[model samples]
Target: MRLKPRQLEAFRHVMLTRGVTAASEAMNIAQPAVSRLIRDLESEVGMTLFTRQGGRLLPTPEAVLLLAEVERLYIGIDQVARAADDIRQHLNVVLRMASVTSLVRPFLHRAMMEVVGPRLDLPLVLDVENSRHIWDMVEQSHYDLGLVFGPPRQGDLQTVHLHSSTAVAAMPPDHPLAEKDVITPTDLLDCRVLTAGRNSPLRRGLDRAFSQAEQAPLNTLETSMLNCCHFAAAGMGVAIVDRITMRAADVKLCAKPFLPTIDVSYYAARPAGSRQILVLDQIVERIKELLDEDTVIAS
Candidate 1:
């Protein structure tokens, strides 16, 4: 039996909110109407979608799997609608972009907003994924642009340098090392080092710095989450993090420039033959403008 789009929407809402009352509020419908929609959907599918236990709605495995597909369908529907609106208004095409987690929060997103401002009629779709995941999506032509922390070695992709910044040693404000204006890798040899996962470029730089100092590999605490590195530094463990990450006001971490700075580069990559390369080039230019502005103001 084919499920109606409205029924699928109701199912997704219930699965997301996990409570009929919450789903009803979100859908802007009465609770009884929401319940009826769910019941109809379950009957049409010939299966129980959610399990009720202790007043909590738990999704069955089948329902969870279906919810994932429904999310993608809805995202595509939204994109189509926005594209139509953009065409009607004679607006520049919306460029779908994806970026690694490292550039998500304050860098790439900020730069995009500054570049487009309120002038663009089409909504830019930005997806944040890990570096490897973003590259895979780029290979599939799922995104027009991909922002990554490191260079792309593949021949099929063309990359343009966007910005570069040096990594700094971060420590809690009250930590002993915070008193120093500049920190060296040797200074951290005896301290616990908080770093990103082994595969991340930031971690690779940290490793190289220690190797150059001829120190035993640091007592590393590896984490995949960038926020965890911030917290680790705030809690007294020394972390080598990009300058943008050290700027969080709530972190209470003092950043000291590394004696031999580790340079990190950001690149915008696009399929070499894709027509969307023009959009990527525009974005890369905007990124350079912002970085240059920051450098001039700082100087």
Candidate 2:
């Protein structure tokens, strides 16, 4: 009835990478050894975890359920490792935060430094991920806090609004649309626009704007809001997303107002179990102050 750590590890990697050979490489073991581990795990669970289909290992229904549980188990294991790190360093608490890329540098990092400044040895793990991933990390209690796109969908997360801004039309400095003070969907009729993917909340808002103009986005590229600027700067298309992405992009891009604006907001979300309340409060306040002063957020 007991499942071994190596067995679970092999099963999880197989489910994630989708092949025994790939899983073996990831676990730094031989391919046949991976097959044997999977077989032993299947025996322990008494279920067929995978079926071969077109040279791919496809998870069965039971395997899918096991994968979810296995993932949670791994998350717990990761938390334990972090705890061990904290103890090894003889720290009372460590700050683990995840954030969207747009929220860093001139914004979140400055605020974080002001709070944790004096403690040079203080362990801080700041992970930069997409907002969707940040949301999940905070909700799962993997991180103490997360700065992400607003309107927290998870009921358990306590959040405070940090900033709000309108989406903009971003393009290369010399793009035709850059000539307009305010770019609308009609202005982009002949252009290939870049926009958030269909699954994104930003996409829904952008779709409404296009609908109001009675125009299709003409956007052939569906990407992350962050990538909109990068893709547009390459002259692939015009970007319509939060201004921060355009300003945050490594390459230069021009951001202009978008007619029929799409508003976007970011918030600080955290679970109730955080011990760094004073530091969190200070960081939140500092971010709000920076948001007010940072012209990049004034879009």
Candidate 3:
């Protein structure tokens, strides 16, 4: 009794779609052919994998257990294929990277492209979200590496600091504060400010800075996207954002160092007991080198 690779693929697809008709359509095969494959597979294994009810395929208990094992097997197969491709092309291994939304474009994406070179045979699948979600995914081993704006304060994770940069204030070119070499919390007392949402690290830092400075808080327009804040800034609102974000915007905005500069350090992180730490370390080191190169070129 041998279950072939094609049978396994059919079973996995049926389980995923939970409908033989849809699975058959996806596989570009006739429904009867899919049904025959599943039947043959069950006969060989001596177990009923699915039960049909209300025209839907429902997995049996045995099928659920088998599905988990099958998923792992497929993942291993994928890794093998990817590894072979990398070797054939003389490329670094493919890495799955996740990062907070704000850092994805200007920081993580650029740094990786610079360090990994323009011809990337090694692919990176990037997931961008808020820091909390990124941390959650990393802890669950959903990503090979994670880039975060600040150190993890609550998670049991391993981290390597990539680099630190100062926060800056952005405003439209014609805005009053745009002419300043630098701006302080006191200077923004009555201004309308655009910022990332309250949960963001940048927002948290700005709140603390304002509290310490004892300045009245400005009216804040909160959004989760750094780009949106930049857009608002270009529309005549003052925005306090990381320098990396400000520099990437295409709007007519001026960026100035924020007084008592809010410094941010980005870190690469993975779960504490991860076996893939070596790969993540390589990525972090490469990013740091890229940042150094950028600094040298700019200077």
How do the residues 1-299 of candidate 3 rate in per-residue lDDT, one tens digit apiece?
A: 77888788889999998888888998999999899999988998999999988888889999999999999999999999987876666467556778776566565666666666565456667887777777778888787788877756566788877777877788877877778888998888778777777777777888888888977456777875466555655574778886556544545667778877777777778877866434446667876776666557644
Deviating ranges (above 4 Å) for candidate 2 = 1-92, 273-276, 296-299
lDDT of 1 at 227: 64
Candidate 2 residue-wise lDDT, 1-299, digit = tens = 99999999999999888889889999999999999999999999899999999988899999999989999998999999988886665366667888887788667878877877888766678899877888888878988888887656758677888878888888889997788889888888888888887756677888888877876655468877778888888998988888666555667888888878788888898876654466667888898788877755453
Alpha-carbon TM-score of each model against the true structure: 0.60, 0.64, 0.60
Instruction: Report the Cα RMSD per candidate.
Output: 17.6, 19.3, 14.2
**What count of clashes does model 3 give?**
0
Cα lDDT over the full model 2: 0.82
- How many backbone collisions does model 2 have? 0
Residue-level lDDT of model 1, residues 14-84, one tens digit each, is 88888889888888999889888988999998989989899888999989888889899999999999878
What is the C-alpha local distance difference test score of candidate 1?
0.74
The lDDT values for all models are 0.74, 0.82, 0.75
- The number of clashing residue pairs in model 1 is 0
Model with the higher lDDT, candidate 1 or 3: 3
**Where does candidate 3 clash, by residue pair?**
none
